[model samples]
Target: MATTAISADTSARPAAWPRALLLIGRVALGLVFVVAAYTKLHFNGAWHFSDYYFFFGMAINSYNMVPFWAVELMGRVLPWFEVALGLALISGIALRWVGIVASVLLLAFIGGMARAYVLGLEIVCGCFGNSEKLGPLTLARDGSLLVLALAVTVGAFLIKKRAERVRAVLAARQETVSS
Candidate 1:
């Protein structure tokens, strides 16, 4: 039951409106990132705060994938990265590249989860500062977000191609009229 706030005029626009679709995709993905970051940054009240970064480190360490030396660094940086991605996606600047990066990150998360599952390590998701044990549901959620990111990429390309065709057609018409 997800409701998109995209404008209703999308259908009325020209066929080369992949940009419109891309915008919708960006906002959707951006929201997920924002919420994830908020959970870490605002977990405890304004005055009292949870050590989300440290907890996240513990959660990630439970997976036993990342090297010991890198765990702390990653835990500290990941939340900030998610916030950046959220802002970038919502801004619609470099939409295609942002979508690509989001997809790649989602893949990495999914990979980590998959490995943990194989090893019987029921680690917390740590995605939204949640301590719930990981399982198939996490995989499905990440997979769905991946699909949205890819859709934005494909849509943007379609818009670019259509714009090119339109430009070519207009140039041809101008040439014929001048002659």
Candidate 2:
């Protein structure tokens, strides 16, 4: 029995540059989180007792959205969370999910900055270290990060779809050969 041919241009490989770029984006985002976490958790990068908890608490308080009770808690928890997420991204364990999380985190930062800007609050972002004030630059930086993570997520999704297409082509060919 002769089977119909499966034509999908499978001979043409998908461009690898997009996948490489996705890896680059993931690593870059991971590095950002790692550096931020390190700066927040350590004082002056000397591994000494850092004032991050106290200073970060003050920073969060400046945002005015967090209640007094949660301000300190958030300040205390955020750094560790950053570290974990950074490690995960760097490890490339779950690129899609991590990219999504990174994007969400950036969005949160952007929202926070927007809130401060609208409220005319002249507070430091305290992301890496103590900054002069939270202004347009801070928002722009976070917005850039959001864009990066979004690109990573989209790239990963496309790669996945491409892989599925290849598998489908292979399965179809196998069925034809057997028939």
Top candidate, metric lDDT: 2
**Each model's TM-score?**
0.81, 0.89
In candidate 1, which residue ranges exceed 4 Å CA deviation? 1-13, 16-19, 46-51
Q: Per-residue lDDT for 27-86 in model 2, tens only?
A: 898999999888777765455344567877887788889788899898888888999999
Residue 31 displacement (Å), model 1: 0.7
Clashing pairs in 2: none
lDDT (C-alpha) at residue 131 in model 2 = 62
Per-model CA lDDT versus the true structure = 0.76, 0.81
- C-alpha lDDT of candidate 2 relative to the true structure: 0.81
TM-score: model 2 vs. ground truth: 0.89
Candidate 1, residue 74: the lDDT equals: 81
